[model samples]
Target: MIGPNLIPVGIAGLGSYSPKRILTNWDLEQIVETSDEWIFQRTGIRERRIAEDGEDSGKMGAVAALRALEDAKLSSDRIDLILCATTTPDKPFPTTACHIQNAIGAKNAGGFDINSACSGFVFAFNTAAQFIATGMAKRVLVVGTEKLSTILNYEDRNTCILFGDGAGAMVLSPLDEAGRGEYLGGSIQTEGGKDDVLEVPAGGSTLPTDKRVLEAGLNKMVMGGNRVYRFAVSTFVKLVRQAVEPYGFEQLGRIVPHQVNQRIIESALEKLDLPPETAFSNIHKFGNTSAASVPMAFDEAYREDCLIKGKLACSVAFGAGLSWGHFLVRW
Candidate 1:
């Protein structure tokens, strides 16, 4: 697992935000043909957040980004790059990152969007780290945010019950001169042939949005549950191994996995023979926030003192396009 050399990068700060509106399983039962017990048994998500009308991904992302900058004790002007990892952009032409940059007053930063679905945060973080590692950017802000409720088909109990809205952000910069920060590289794999396994069936370039697409629900997310469950379990195990192999078992401090499903995390970790405590899960509170899951969970673990400066932390995720990725950082 020894990999190519990389310049060390550091996590400058972290912050996250979930909407105030909570949609519990009981509430879901009233709207959809599902039960709390059934949802709990399968997904382990007791509740999830939903944005109020007019609160889009960009707005939520802006708040999280500001908090992240505050945590790092830096101003918005210091940010030279803003990478937003999201699937539910406010619009296709103006990226959610653009709105966030302006909202947070990051006038000096160049902003863009990354749409790798659930794996977006991990992908964006690694991409932003390279900027610091190669001296392309001094300070970067990476945010994983989603407004999945906007694109969910409530009539479909399967997909509707599994998604939520939220955002998580992190600040990245060159390692401190004291050599306290480190960035260990990770791996990513994609199975394009399996792209149809999980995705929004329409609303993209090929399947441009139309009244028919909207009426048919093709514009919303549709997943092959059985296929995705199997893929996720195997992919999680593979990504975790790649994420930890470079540092060995002893140096592996913690794993912050995407909160897609509690059962998926449990099954994968059990197969890997790692104790449940080694991984973190917030699905019960946040549900499947797509790109927001990993970073949101990582922030919770960090606040509890689990992710310390000398300890290593690995975050991994899997999502649409059959994409999966791992990212390791030393806080």
Candidate 2:
């Protein structure tokens, strides 16, 4: 809860980076037993970005961070904290946030990582806002980067076709009287006991990597698509209403949602009684980028003038861990 003594935080700038290589649905036809029509009808994705040989999560995050700093017209040294949200960190050690700090030359910033699957970006954004709200930070760089391609088993069409590689970033700072956007508040909910619904079953403390595990493709992403789809459809509506209803529908500019699936998003919007264009989505272009999805969509929507100045914009996301989050912004 925000206290009267706490300072308000606002988004200073936004940026996103998508890899150059485009993997079309037709390409998936060659890779797996799926056709373009089948995939698009189900997920509303026609193509997705594939990171190049040298593009890792850290590098992608750094690029997006630099772009965000440029957009904000602020230097990296001004950042007080760096928060990165990702399921696919460049490495388990040192944290992807550390790599980004070094790469971006954020010499004065302390950094860390947050892993909440696809809900990660919203989680990280809320955490960043707290540091600023408490006056511990004046500028916080929040990044959501994922090199999901690294952990995918391409042969498995179910999960492989649903994710891509990318990064998105935003600079959050204490709101000033003239600030263009304000971070209003947010809500988050997590349902445990559903970790098996979507997970990378191995390479963790519970299931350390082994020769046998590697042979079984245990490190690759596994998902119960139907279950996740149902959860997303319902939870998306709940989260949007929870964050947006208090402010009223007419006051909202746009809903930036985690680009998980086109069908899921559409279903939720229908249930919420919102217009088709009420929410902006790029899943058709980038598939589900996990934590990177929401921020990436934010960047695109802002650039396209979908999120207008002096208007309210809300971001919502959900993923593995059965976790979901939403944040309200007055832009």
Candidate 3:
């Protein structure tokens, strides 16, 4: 078992990045059989960022990481480890984290990428926290980024309207206090049976890309919207209760959930008896950036002073792998 005197890990800084190119709902009308009203009513997304053709997952992650390092008043050389979580990587080999390391000039730090769908950031956070708590690393950079627009099928209204491109990052370091500064309390669960509900149909080793497969657009994300929605609502409520209740946060200050959809957020709030305002949502501005959504919302909250010192904040997310988890932090 871990010792009670173990070093406490706290978030030293936070940052996020969204491409300047905006893709509004009006852009969808020309491509799919949907209108702004229909998409807005169902998903609460009006616009989302689309990375430029030259920008890939690695570059976006690097941008966000640099901002985080700046916020911490630390340089890249000071970092001990870098963990980049993403579903869309520049390539399978070199590891996206390595690319970010190169971009940021963190020559001393070595890291890798994690592919846990939306639960990726939380997983990476937990992993980095362990390293800090155990004295393996002094400072670690955890980033979640994606260029989903590249893999999305613009013709499919249902899925296309639900995704966007962006990145978010955090600097985790050991805290002097015990049980202070971003103490995460929750369990991570995955139901492989429901994995098929949301997935990219092809293009990996199981189904390598080919001319015929390319023509059929097999590399794009395909989601069963209704099924995933049902699972998300249920999981969000359960994880929130489990994480905050034990800590006695009956009046939890803020909840930064994954910006998947407005409806899903409302459903989870209703089930948890939380007021609509208790949840911080930017789906309208950034769509579902998957793993990046929670941290992106966090950076916005901090900038707007929505998360005050001593306030209890909870971050929750659910996604493919049918995976879900929660992290509670005292700012």
Candidate 4:
């Protein structure tokens, strides 16, 4: 199941949605001890989108999925599977995928959710691709949606400045022999041992929410930025190297990576001897939308014409399972 029986898969359509609210660095400047310049220099992010009180990942993802369906010239009922990737869902029960499916009127679509923190979208995309490849499905909708603003501890400037809320969706269908492009090979890996370095202290079975947990400030996100940064850079470089292997960077049209940090992307690309221009990033505008980062970047790059049809693209991401993975595609 792991090797050699590959089948060609390609992106059929793409769309992304971002909330209307703008949270500028200057706005954050008033809330924390940080300045716009400091935040820019450190994360290469100037602003990010914030979901309104009633907005959730499901709502945003449904919008994105509808747009993708429109882009592909397909109807919602045509989709065979729907995969929702997110860290922040509207509720604990009724997976976000169900919400999107219901919202979009995708009665025929079987759906579920995936939580790989930031690396979720790519993981979901590849998993859906495999289903198509195996002849188990014909059309799949994969969405990376996040309401990170809800979980973030605004008091912690370190984590607050690094995330945002958004959703990105893409349609996947098998490619014919003469199709314009194909999804080549890629890898997904995680280092569970390193989970302690980055996590939310409570709200899960390990530390269910209680007044004490709330009073102790254990219900929000917590991150060891320095350690995560180090791991990010190393894991990023390794994934790229492994993904490119025999095919090589020269065959790639662009590298759309998880928008965790500009510095990490730049450093990892530099370490890999890859050109700066080859990396496509929208972090400056959206910060890190966790699982939404890679797909959001992909959608933006496609809109900007950076992701031209018939060109190869590599998507790499690292997130909280201490999860890190990469996928290759041709647009």
**TM of each candidate vs. truth:** 0.96, 0.98, 0.96, 0.96
In model 1, state the lDDT of residue 85.
Answer: 98
What's the residue-level lDDT of 72 in candidate 1?
85
TM-score of candidate 1 versus the correct structure, residues matched by position: 0.96
Task: Give one digit per residue, the lDDT tens place, for model 4 in 1-331.
Answer: 2246756787878889999999999999899889999999999999999999889999999999988888777899999999999989888879999999999999999989999998899889889888888878888999999998877888889999999999999998877722433777666777787667878878888899999999988878888759989989998888878877667667778889999999999999899988898899889999999998888898888779897576678899998878988898776
| Ten contiguous residues minimizing lDDT sum, candidate 4 | 177-186
What residue pairs are clashing in model 3?
310-331
lDDT tens digits, residues 132-241, model 3? 88889989999999999878998888799989999999998876522234665545677787756888878899889899888999899888869988888888888888
Residue 265, candidate 3: how far off, in angstroms? Answer: 0.6
Candidate 2 residue lDDT tens string, 149-178: 999999999988899999999999988821
Q: Rate the local accuracy (lDDT) of all candidates.
A: 0.87, 0.92, 0.86, 0.87
Candidate 1 wrongly placed segments (more than 4 Å): 1-6, 177-181
The Cα error of candidate 3 at residue 3, in Å, is 4.8
Flag regions of model 4 displaced more than 4 Å: 1-6, 177-181
The predicted structure with the larger lDDT, 1 or 3, is 1
TM-score of 2: 0.98
